[model samples]
Target: MQRKKPYLQPYWWRLLFRANGTAAWEAMGRGPLIPVPNAALTRAPLEVWADALLEEAPYELEDLHGDLLLECYAEPAVTDGTPPVYSRQVRLPGK
Candidate 1:
């Protein structure tokens, strides 16, 4: 008999970055020099979209390997009178 796969809900997207020089700028009060075009980053896979955000800096895919990191989740705005809640988790490539 085959085991059933668990149903995983697609939680809202977020970005995880290793705290470095360029990342520091985005973190500090430097303002967002590179504006995220839309909320697309959250929906796209990390490997596919992460590079675009790091375009101006020197970054390598391997650089992200085994590094302690910080993640930022762009919370969704609630239109109705409901409150907003954010989800977070430590995600590795190919869970």
Candidate 2:
């Protein structure tokens, strides 16, 4: 049987935020595209990171909503040219 490695394929991510009902969106950040094989490992840290970003003062949480896009890639910048494997959008705190 093949043993599972402690670290698995890294998940790539990019976070974008925009005003409510707006077409314009800006890329706020992206996690280091490193291998993290399991989805369980990826979810918590990425979400925590997003929550932290929203808390930062630079962003005016009001009128802002965003989505976290995640894709599993074996290597950095692989661009397998596919849709994100996972995606979720949330409204930032404030109106």
TM-score for each model = 0.23, 0.46
lDDT of 2 at 57: 28
lDDT of 2: 0.51
Off by over 4 Å in 2: 1-4, 30-75, 78-81
Candidate 1 pairs with clashing backbones: none
Going through the candidates in the order shown, the clash numbers are: 0, 6
Tens digits of lDDT, candidate 2, 33-54: 5444356555566445444544
Candidate 1 regions off by >4 Å? Answer: 1-35, 39-47, 59-70, 76-95
Model 2 residue 37 CA deviation (Å) reads 11
Number of the top TM-score candidate: 2
lDDT of 1: 0.35
The per-model lDDT (C-alpha) reads 0.35, 0.51
